[model samples]
Target chain A: MTDSKDTGEAGEVKKDHGVLYIGMDFGTSRTSVSASNGVRETVYSTVGYPKDIVSMKLLKKDVLFGKDAIERRLSLKLYRPLEKGVIKMGDDADAESKANLKAARDLIGEAIRIAKPRADELVYCVIGAPAKASIHNREAIIEAAREHVDSVMLCSEPFAVAYGLDWLEDVLVVDIGAGTTDLCRMHGTMPEETDQLMFDTAGDAVDAELAKQIQDTCPGAQFTVQMIKDIKERYGFVGEAAERVVVDLPVDGKPTPFDLTDQLKTACTVLIEPILEGLRRLIATFDPEFQAKLKGRVLLAGGGSMVKGLDTAVEKAMNERLGGGKVIRIEEPVYGGSNGALKIAHDMPEDFWEQLK
Target chain B: MAGFKETLKDAVRQMSFRTSLDKLKKKGVQNVNVLGVDRIIALIEAAVHRSLKSRMVGIDRDAVAESTKAEFLRLLRSNEDLQREKSQIEQARERAEEEIDLMRRELGEKRSLLRVKLEQDAMELVTRYSGENQAIAMKVAEICRSFAESGDASVSSVEERLMELVMDVVSGEREEAEVARKALQDREVGNLQRRIKKLNDTLVTTEQRLQQASTMKQFDRGISSIYREVQGLDGSDSHAGKKRELMVDLFKANLKLQKRGKGA
Candidate 1:
């Protein structure tokens, strides 16, 4: 409903149609969105531009994202704009950095678009950022999202997970993302800088370890990082082998099967040590009475948390080291952060959204 | 303005069927020089100026340039005229489709009516002939009984033979008339069949018109949002107080970051 109309440059105007609250998980490997309109979608955090004029004409697109970017990478100059759950560009203004910035901006737009907010709707968004993200990183994210949404805010990823689950107090959240794993302790209040720990040993690290293992053991097994990521997402496990992790890789243009059970277990289990260490430090430093409570509710979330048997493996490790601890893996680990962020967007006061706008 | 430039470029590109060198070679071309769109436009402008310089005096050159500019505007106006004509053609196509639908319904109705009329005529003839034959048989039986009642064998035999001959002659004449009537009915059926065939041909022609109309372009339909108004935090939630604090903190942080960004 339009209370008043103001003529724009070409006399363009729009009604105050509605409000759309979007929650985005801006991850290193994947970006996900959840909207109030019941739209939920995820895309890999990769952007690609066609390499040359021929490719530009053939692909018929100026840019591609997610599976298309990965699948058509040979014809593209692909850029993973985000690494370690933040924009990769630094203070130095180089060509590559500027390109990365554009790619990151496009990626943010793409993520919001996939949420499918109506053109007339006012889009208010909340993004789950890494706890250790710099102020510059937060500003960049907000700036990128502003072009597509009316207003936006950033919340720590692990805390978003904790908030999503309503485990606001006495909960230890371990969010294992692709580039970084974030650990935050919830104490029914805002988590200060000291209450959160972030580390780089995460899904990408697992992918690297798996790649290394494949190189050492399965010689001549031709694979790309994209292929490795697919395999890891499909069959990555820790602690024990459910069955033999059998996958086919091409060797000199011939298909060959490799047993990757040990490799996958070894790589996936790398998350446990960092998580346990972080959990120990956070729990040790928490309030004495709540430390036991926090230890009892170790919430495991994120895409990296999808590794089969990871929860049990981490639980088993906690028993050995922390005397006794409980580990709980969230349902829908891929959308945990986004779902929480969406809730935050919905809960944020209307005045705050208007003020930001 | 950017969009308008892209539109012009697209129009130029669509008009020119440019091919790659590799494609030309595949088509058995020995060698070909490539020309880009920018160069092609430049060459056209140069050719126009060259023609004006070579064929016209100083004032005439200016006059020719103005005429060429006028011609370009005329062409653009004609293109708009063509667009209007296209819409008119589309409306005619829609009318043709409606006529086709009407014809199809008429054809079905005509076919059913022809079949029912043929069946009714056949049933009427059968009932009439059956009644006439029954009446004639009764008359012949009465004549034979009357001759027997005269009590003379030879007279009765003579009358019976004569009656048989009369009955055979009349029956033969009736068969001839029946044959003539059947021929007339066949002619009527043939005429109806011809009309049906013509209707079928027209139906096919109109169907093709419909297929042409089906190629019309479509536009995008936007999605609808779930909320008509902003839904802030629910007041009844038990954790409303705690979530409010978190929301305020998040807002404060974002406000600061944005303020700093704007300052920068």
Candidate 2:
């Protein structure tokens, strides 16, 4: 493969290999990737390994991910590797934690594999990690990604969202994910430690709250957390709902319809308070001259932003609490971080990648 | 050269195997000769020494003997390598067979799953159509009863008119629907058959690849990349300078984190 490469001034053979740049948004619920080769994919963060000999024989697979893993969960030992925006690996880890780490590693590998990078290409990747992930968590993520790519870098998730849209300066980004909501203030240069805040009141919290509400309001309605999550993803809204959120739950082995409008709104409402508070803190600490600019361009991104009327709800709250603010929901919330990470990967100089490799 | 003795001994042992006396007689080999390893080695050396003594009177006998031994050892080494390559090919062939078996099993699973899905759809359609037919019949009967009570027509006349409507209108509609349903089923079956054909084609290709691999195992070179080195920020990009600085900061942080991790 290197036989036809040109020699340099020093008479040293220089290899001429192709480069495949990949951007990964490694979130608690989903792992999304976009490659320079125009391949984009999103998979659930769930990983499953066949439980035993019989299950292995039936599945004819060593592991499964995404929809396949979710569907065949009963026959597999499932692992949601990331929780609360960080890989769940600690120093004094137990066997389950070790297994989760393995699953996380495999999930990263799978994300790269789905990008379909050429074998002879140099896979350069940039991952958008949680803003407040611990050093240990960051190391874990780097280790996992390094196994698949030639070079990798980790940037703050919310910052990536803002950068993706070229809203680098005087912009506040609120990335609401399943496990945690990350808020970062971008002021031209790289965001500092004080520019970011994280809270665990995003999508999963809504699901939990909705489950509690369903249990309280709809008696005799049987549902699991998974079913509640689906309901929230389908019908979750805040403020005045355009239509009633009615869903069916099994009762005595028969489907029964139940109204869940109030529950869904109340559940989805949990996101607003924390996000507004985060915005206030970030905007309040900004340069007084640029504070207005920052509040004026608040970018709402990530999967949780898909909740109907969420942007308007946040804008309303900001009006009431932070005087006034505009929340612009990104057109492609799910791909925002990944797309930004891809931009970052593309802009990184060759020297930086070589040093990392 | 060091393994020459071992290779020679192995060659001798491999060609010799035990057989029943009756089997040997049946093969018309009732007599056999046994040679010990040490005697065979001595006889080979003596033959070589005698041949060299007679063939080259003026030449250095010791030098020629050494050269001949080196050449023979080289041949033996190549034969050993061939033996190793043969074993590797056998293992690869076995793996290919196992892969074929696995693919066949997967194909079976897919076929059965498709069967179950189609059957479920058929049953659901039947249940839905039966309910619709029952509702239509009840509505027709109700219309006939209402007509009889109104005294606009005789009950027998209403019954005959209703039968005519059923035969002329509903049955024709049902026939068209049946044709459309059959066409839809044919489209679905055609899709599945195409998928099966694709699977069969892939199987054949994989089998061909296995044969090729067994013959020559040299072409595992992977795909090529588009660039030789990492592409930095484009010069024309307006945000190039700032983005590069941010990228550098991120790289430094990551470098420190990785170094710390390694240190730990």
Candidate 3:
């Protein structure tokens, strides 16, 4: 049997409509989504528009997404629309700004599309934005998502992570994304401005640092930023070395193997000091009684948290710096923010959703 | 439940395959041993009946055979119904796709027509204005030449007055023409734009419908969520009160943000 409803006069059958809730983490390097339909997916926060008619014909699409965009970048006017976990736009209108805005919109649309939403469904989305994103940036994100959803809302990224895990009180979240790292102190209520800290020393910064380190140490090493990113993702670690990270890189057009264990360790260690400083500030400024609880429940999340031994390293640094503390990394680092947003979407009242719509 | 012979006859008819003589020949078969499908069916039925008849004496063997035939026929009919349903779904999908294509083509044609009309209107305005300007310039030049040939002391003054008078009349005409042209162009372009927009909306709606149909035809029911409707905080949750309060806070924040966005 088919599910359909008939109109009174037109006698046309309409499909049944269901409510679908989606949670999205719109990050700088990657965008991840979790939907009510048991679908979870992620895409690089990159969008590309074909450069010319010939390329358009060849590509057979007006836009390319994620890895496809990166691989076919020569034929496309590529755009990484988000910088520092917010849509990169200037006050003055320019071609680059317009393109970035379009890309951000397209990227949001693409992220929603991968959720496999049914057309005959009411789609409500909650997006986890940067904790310190400006009002203009928040509006831009909301406007972009509005084009693809029935109703959408924005929440602070680190707050979402904590909410998803049901850690309401005295827990500190360190969400290290590609563009920005957010440290939010949850105190059983909404986090305020002073309760959160954001900085640009995140995954992208680490990549830049790693690339610089390689360039300075390894002579004639030919590697791009992407290559450096891949190396970091595969071999980035702090603390003691586990195995020698000997990687093949082109040198003067020839493949050459270089041991990058020390370089990677040094580069990844850049996250520790800044994170410690942020932790010290949040912990020190907190109520004296719950400061220890906040320090003990420091949660490491985001793509950068996937680095091997990061939790242990952070704990080690905390023990040395803040008397003694405990650190826990979320099991699903990539989906933490998205899952939290989904939970919020679920808990949100229907009237609220309708009003937003 | 029919007679055994009749059931056999039906089974034979259902099992028979029709083929052309050329097809058999193409398969390199010079001659084939022909056996009637009904004869084979009868033999199989007879063997089954004989085996059953010997295996049990008290049981109603004829009834058993009849029920078996009825079940087999029922299954065959159900299979036919399923096949028909599949074919109908395929047809529906095909029709939807065709409708989408038609809508797309119409939208494309309407857009191109709009573009051409705009271009034509622009070209007409440019050509008409250029001709009018050229004629006005020629008349002015003739007036100046006449003044020069007279060799009067006030020739330059007369030429200047004549030029001003000609230019004023030309300018007034040009202004009227420009206003009329703009009004006409705007009306035509507005109508075309409305039509194109309608066509585009129709195309998009149709494509969405087609996609929905295709998805339905391709996938089974998707994984359903645990909650059928909107759910708030569970009462059993340990921090139900806290989560509810947080929900309220989140809602307030979003409500504020959305209201601000709308105001902007």
Give each model a TM-score: 0.66, 0.65, 0.64
Q: Model 2, range B81-126, lDDT digits (tens) per residue? A: 5458667877778888788888788778768867987898799778
**Residue range A1-357, candidate 3, lDDT tens digits:** 132342111122222457788999999999999999899999989899999999999997999999999899999998999999989999997989988999999999999888877655668899999999998888899989987777899999999999999998999999999999999999998899999999999999999999999999999999988899999999999988999999999999999999999999999999999999999999999999989888889999999999899999999989998998999999999999999999999888889887786
lDDT of every model, 2 decimals: 0.84, 0.84, 0.86
For model 2, residues A52-124, the per-residue Cα lDDT tens digits are 9999999978999988999999999999999999988778889988999999999999998888876456789
Docking class of 3: incorrect
Collision pairs in model 3:
none
Q: Which residues of candidate 3, in runs, are more than 4 Å off?
A: A1-16, B1-226
Question: What are the RMSDs of all candidates, in order?
Answer: 17.3, 19.1, 25.8
Interface DockQ per candidate: 0.24, 0.23, 0.14
The structural similarity of chain B in model 2 to the true chain B, as TM-score, is: 0.55
What TM-score does the first chain of candidate 2 have?
Answer: 0.95
Ten residues in a row with the worst lDDT in model 3 chain A? A6-15
Second chain only: TM-score per model?
A: 0.42, 0.55, 0.65
In model 1, what are the clashing residue pairs, if there are any? none
Top-DockQ candidate index = 1
